[model samples]
Target: MSDDVRDSLIPYDEIVQDALRAVVGRVLSQIVGYDSLPGEHHFYITFKTQAVGVDIPAHLIAKFPDEMTIVLQNRFWDLKVEQDHFSVGLSFNQTPSILTIPYASITAFVDPSVDFGLQFQVSDDDDTQPEPHDEADNDRPEVISEDGSNVVTVDFGKKR
Candidate 1:
């Protein structure tokens, strides 16, 4: 048999990416509807801090300097989830701050309590671009953690 690849007229990549991003929105909607986290079901969401429509606090921006992870449990208010993004108010060291994050900006979502997670591949055309660094620095990804609860990572390396 001859080995030949066939192409179809379906944009599967874009379709799949849109659907996966919807999962993030749906999950957030469920949480907002319930008005409280179930049991110990908290989320550690990591997203591009510089992406469009992201409204993280100034202090957090200074601390993170890149991306930042936020917890959605115990002390959060004004949770609103839209089609392309979500917004919520969270407190940092007893100070209230409002944050708006687009779903596309999200790179990782994890619920380590159940060993469940989802890592997404960002499109090259997205407005948010990775920071430029030397080859040595590019070899290693930066890890940021707060309280060592649930962890998720977004690596833009080719799969081996």
Candidate 2:
């Protein structure tokens, strides 16, 4: 293979990214449709709190600042998935609340029991750039092991 630069009219990377994100939406839709989860099937969805179409609470935005992880399991309601986003009702120490998250905002999605996961690339609109946002924050691994057990990390990075 030779290293060369070429331009195409279609943006293949963007299209594939969109499709992969849709998988997350479709999976969530199916789980919500079942009305309950089977065995240890659960999701830990991590997303950018400040991204477009994300509708988290002000307090949550302050707390998470950059990103946040949400678990969809025993305590949720009104699960709705849309083209570019999804919304769900959750509780903060018994305080009921609703949140809408765009697929573009998502950074990572994990199912520890099944060892399945997906990590999304940041959108162009994000002003964070390639520079580290925070030294301590960058030092921490992007995906943390769930339940203190080995978890698989899937890399989408590839050469086309």
Candidate 3:
């Protein structure tokens, strides 16, 4: 057998990414009605600051610039989960800020209590560019072909 792998025309990368992002949505949805995270289940969600549909405060954007990680352990409110994005109220420096982050913009999701994590790779062909970081600095990758504390990483870049 040859070592050559074919580039898929089915956009497997996009499909996988979308599906994995949905996992994040589903997990969040579960906590919506209760309005609280269950027993020892806090989250650390990281996302791109400048993605297409992200709505965060200006100061946060300035501070994060490329990426930001928010902890959902406690002291959060207005947890809203939608098909493509999620919004929550969090306090930074004692100042409350609401963040609306699209699933497309999310780079990582971690439930440290369970040692679970997901990382993604985001690309904005025209005016934006994907952040440069380690393969697993919370990149929200879709493909789950790695070993590290239940962390699922999605990377479909073709090898040429």
Taking all chains together, each candidate's TM-score versus the true structure is 0.69, 0.75, 0.81
Model 1 ranges with Cα > 4 A deviation: 1-11, 33-35, 124-160
Indicate the residue-level lDDT of 109 in model 3.
85
- Total clashes, candidate 2? 0
Poorest lDDT segment (10 consecutive residues) of candidate 1: 133-142
lDDT of 2 at 1: 39
Best to worst by TM-score, what's the order? 3, 2, 1
Question: What are the Cα lDDT values of the candidates?
Answer: 0.68, 0.72, 0.79
Question: 144 in model 1: Cα distance from truth in Å?
Answer: 14
What is the overall TM-score of model 3 with all chains considered together?
A: 0.81
lDDT of 1 by residue, 12-122 (tens): 655766777788889889878554578888776777676777888877766665566777766778899999999988777778888999988887776655555666666
Name the lDDT of candidate 2. 0.72
Highest TM-score among the candidates is held by which one?
3
TM-score of candidate 2 to 2 decimals: 0.75
Model 3 residue 106 lDDT score? 88
